[model samples]
Target: MSVTPQASGAASERTGLRVTYDGVVYPAEEIARGAAYELFSADEATGFEWAPRPGTTWPWRRFVHVTEVTEVQGGNEPAEEPEAPLLVPLHRNRSWSSVHQLSQQPAAADDPTLAAVRGSATVRRGTRMVKVLTGRQLAGYVRGWLPHGFCYREHDIAHLRTPAGLAVLRGDGTSGREGTDIGYALRWRAADPGDFDAPVGETYRGLLALPPRDRLGPPVLGTGFVPSSAQLIPEFVTRDFADLPMPANASLLAYTAEGTEVVLYTYQAEQRGWLRMVGPQWRHLLAAVPGLSPDQEYVPTGDVPRSTQLVGSYAGGEYEAVADLPGGFRVLAMTRAARFPVDSVARRLRYARWRGVPCLVLREEAGWLRLRLCRPDPDAVVDTGAQCHERGVYETWAPAPEVTDDQVVDLSYLV
Candidate 1:
């Protein structure tokens, strides 16, 4: 049987997807009956597409294949042995077939952490130092379904060796806050130890060594895609932790009380590049660290200036910001071209359920929208989308008189 990587604009045409199922890559026609799967669009040169489905709005199910993949040596030759999956580096993009292939393989044969995850009989969660030794181990695995690329960076490679195995801990000087909507941090284990002996960047380059395509599309645009497997690691770890079943009397505060006392100047730290926690979370920190106190030093932050093009008129005026919110943040509109009120806007900005938690969308600066969980900060200026929903209102940032819901083009072309 013949198998090949999908072609440009093939999805829109009669040619269906190149789907990977049960360790095999099959054309759309050859996909086994009753197979459960998702779709991936070809690289930029080939535009994104959606199939006829049962909804007025698009479901965020399809993903675009961003990695460089092509036919290998003896392109048309018969298979000698099932081809070993190509392992892409952490924080990089991969083709759907590559991701599917990598997911099936064992992360590491001798890794204890993975064994714990699988509920292996031999693995044990012993009394280990909590601070010095992190419960989380860096394991290797490919991104399952989400679109990945922004997290890639150049940094010194660090490895942590536990009773489990050698873990490749990703280290970068860049701030985590900078990037497109963070999909999730990926933890991977090396399939081969020799992969570690080589420089990490060199290894990544080797894995991503496919020749460049003559026709490539621009990078994905903001708000065009959502990550399906973004929180896999956190969810998996949380489930495993819950499954272990700690005792009813288990007190996290008491548990840490037995450990050596550790003091932290949280407020001072926040002033010097650390994050500030509020309320019960602060108590949780106090439980973990001995001498920590609430914002006793309550250092106030000055308002960061943001200029918006606000207009006042008779039938209410046209108001728009010079910048639009970052992609992925959903918003609710309170008013259109009305005199911006200070008190009423605060009342309108209440937390609503987002991904099962309360959230408000605030466009802080150009190319960045913050989905804050707690109440909006005192200085926050919330956007009502000018009477639009989710990301639709962002279209008004264009020079046209006003952008409607139908006018929002597929910005994924930039992606």
Candidate 2:
């Protein structure tokens, strides 16, 4: 199915707006005013193929609450809303455990209804994706860690503004602690929907099989949703568990017990750094983030190694680029005017082992591979002489030949 925004002036035609559900068309205006609560997907849907208006990020898909629709254009009653689907939660209550056990069965993936609901969760270019962080994880992103692993869409979890409300989504497994009143998250616009994948089907079966001790957070539910008893928020993982290139204007945020959302930092893609956005009143939040100074106004990420980078060809020469997605990709240049759109674009990242430690090859120079530990631990740092850039992030250089099992990874994209 093709997903593309309609050309200019198409949105102004009210007659052109329509929604199709179960093969029936309805006026979008009536749906918007009555049953529709949100847009779910633009792909394979009618009337939603229009682009988001300027300064808006809404995707084309519209989600209509069938039960809420009182009437239809042709006088037919709306279908009953399907029963809320069950998702596997970590806590074991009698009622939930029985259903949870059922989800673990191999045939669960073949359930058509569940599969369709899982497939409904989609990301578009400009959809804001958020990864709820612990204080430690927040510091890693500040230092240079790229977005990877599990994340959620901001649209799905916007109502979860308080620490208590958001605790269910945390990746650090510290949500069970008493008196926990603060939460952190990294939010960025998706450059492409292909960068994400639902944690369902045969490809993700291994994540579900991981032992408790081997994983960091709640066990993968394998039902394509977060492990929450009260919420059915769908979950997504970066494809192949690889890092996506950080886009411009990504924000590091904090949520308080009082439900206040504060912007902690905004990434400056052009400068390769994060500009502190929190004020002195909220500075105390930084205390829990190791090695980060609340007083520092800016932190440079260029020094820290990154796993993925946007490389573009401009004016017959290739240069490192930055993604300002939904806006476009451009050469990473210092002056604003000189930042020309590249003729071609591709992502470049390398993977290899240094001293038996899996590392990301950031760059190569003179037979040396600048490597960053994929999973940094004390022993890994010691083995590779990787210096601590910040908490949990380490980098060092190794001879090219010593970097065994080396492989270059490249993904091309349209300019």
Candidate 3:
């Protein structure tokens, strides 16, 4: 819809000026010396409308969560200091053919040159990390799963907007399923670059050596990118394959085959829940999500244990904090006014051995500690009695007293 920049008046001073597009109000900021306005919103507000701007491309309305007014600039900003190889999008007409050819390439796990190039890629604290999810994985994250395993930087793949365009980047090995019209993804700001490691070097050689049956997704291409013959999108894994705490405003999204981007849900870290944003028309997307009711407006996740958390000290007391980011980290409070920037913040995680298996302590109950296997294999799952929640993720509970060598550690990644 045509976005009429609100006049610079009293309303601009209060909530800043906003632009309405497709019935949603977005807080707009003047960027590039006022040549274009960047519209961004963390909330899922609606009820406003605007006429479509003439000559707008298909991606215009698809920029649901963030977009620049000029339409030429996608939400992802180019790196201030380029380190990785430049990536250019293929012609829309040739994208599918190119992706198919690239997906067929043999894994380049032993390519030293490619590995070094990929290893050189870096993630800044505020870099947007993206995990393309299957319908089942999307459901898991909506429930309580934190960001873990393999992911990519949003800056590298912003041009791939549609389901077909993103097929090459799928983490699941199996492809070419029919009737798949929508693609799902989770995007969030990186709380710390140290939490990520390129799946290269001797550390990940074992992952590359694993037989096909033992692994879930595509093989780890030491090239630090997806299994593509041409795409240079660098891939990363959480350090020690541990879960990174979900930051505030993390978004669960859906992209139609036609390239319409839908904001399915935006995480509310304070409430430890997801605020559903998908309208009635898109409710069918949730049909594939196991046990999740499409009609439910907000899903509470506080009760579900997590592997890592953001904690902060404020007013002489330690409290759960949310990474609001750019604005900085703050203590998560019930009311908006109560959320204040904390005096100190750190990531709280505990590692322990249960039944001779390395596990990350999720949470502690009366006498039991919920633990997730750091690396899930068939034997580990059986030994720990861990239930398979999703591909490559397993969790179970153990008696707190029986869990040996329990140690709580706090990490600070603030710059």
Task: List TM-score per model, in order.
Answer: 0.18, 0.66, 0.70
Report how far off residue 287 is in candidate 1 (Å).
Answer: 11
Query: Which regions of candidate 3 fall more than 4 Å away from where they truly are?
Result: 1-112, 176-179, 354-357, 363-403
The best candidate by TM-score is 3
Instruction: For model 3, state the Cα shift of residue 281 in Å.
Output: 3.5
Task: Report the poorest 10 consecutive residues by lDDT, candidate 1.
Answer: 138-147
Return the number of clashes found in candidate 2.
Answer: 3
- Model 1 lDDT per residue over 324-348, tens place: 1111111122334332321111011
lDDT at position 222, candidate 2? 74
Tens digits of lDDT, candidate 2, 1-415: 1111232123323334444555655443322123332233434465343435342333453444433234444322434322232233333453544444444444566666556656666777777789988888888899898998779877667656557777888776566374367778899988777778887877666555544543456777777777766565778887765678899999998876544468899999888889998778889978888899999999988677566888999989999988886678998988999899889888887789988988877678899988766654446656888764322235799999887999887788766
Full-model lDDT, candidate 2 = 0.68
Worst 10-residue lDDT window for candidate 3 reads 1-10
Instruction: Encode model 3's per-residue lDDT on 1-415: one tens digit a residue.
Output: 1112232222233545565555555554433223234344443334212323333211122222222232332233533443243332446564544533443343545544444445556787777788888887788888898998788877667656667667777766645263368888999988888888876667655555545665555666545667765455677888767788899999998876544467889998877899999888788877866788999999988577766888898889998888886568888898979898899888888999998888888788899998877765566767888864433446799999889878888888673
Clashes of each: 12, 3, 2
The numbered model that scores best in lDDT is 2
Q: At residue 45, give the lDDT of candidate 1.
A: 16
* Residue 21 CA displacement from its true place in model 3, Å: 28
